[model samples]
Target: MAKGYWITFYRSISDPGALAAYAKLAGPAITANGGRFLARGTAAKAYEQGIAQRATVTEFDSLEQAIAAHESAAYQEALKALGSACERDVRIVEGLG
Candidate 1:
């Protein structure tokens, strides 16, 4: 089966403390749902029209699991904590096995 990837690009983070709080809850929630964070932080370099920003790439056993991790009640709590602290784009894509 193809692996699932959850990618997030943070355009801006207005409140670092809120993000920190969300991470505390989100990490465990994601792990429980079979997520492995491969890379997370500001981009080292940007190319083309891309602008350097904070990003995260996570691998999941499957697409369903990735979706579940994002929607789970635990993750929902994390989102609540995050509130409107940042602007980000999140994507879930399938990759070759």
Candidate 2:
């Protein structure tokens, strides 16, 4: 099956503490649900329309798995901690292969 990926782009951060708190909770929650982080942190550079800000890429077994992980109760808790901390864009996509 094609892999699933969560692509997250941070538009802006309003609270570092909230992000830290969320990260502390989100990491384990994601991993426990079969998510593996592939890349994270701020971009080294942007090309064309790219936004060189904080971002992450997480992989999962399938698209449904990725969606489930995001919608899980644990992740929801993390989201609560992250409430309004930053503007972000999250996309769940199926792998080409």
TM of each candidate vs. truth: 0.95, 0.96
**Candidate 2 lDDT over residue span 1-97, tens digit each:** 9999999999889999999999999999999999999999999998887788899999999999999999999999999999999999999999998
lDDT of 2: 0.96
Q: Which stretches of candidate 2 lie over 4 Å from their true place?
A: none
Could you give candidate 1's per-residue lDDT for residues 1-94 as a string of tens digits?
A: 8889999999889999999999999999999999999999999998896669899999998998899999999999999999999999999999
- How many clashes (backbone atoms < 3 Å, residues ≥3 apart in a chain or on different chains) does model 1 have? 0
Q: Judged by lDDT, which candidate is best?
A: 2
lDDT of each: 0.94, 0.96
C-alpha RMSD in Å of predicted model 2 compared with the true structure? 0.8
CA lDDT of 27 in candidate 2?
Answer: 97
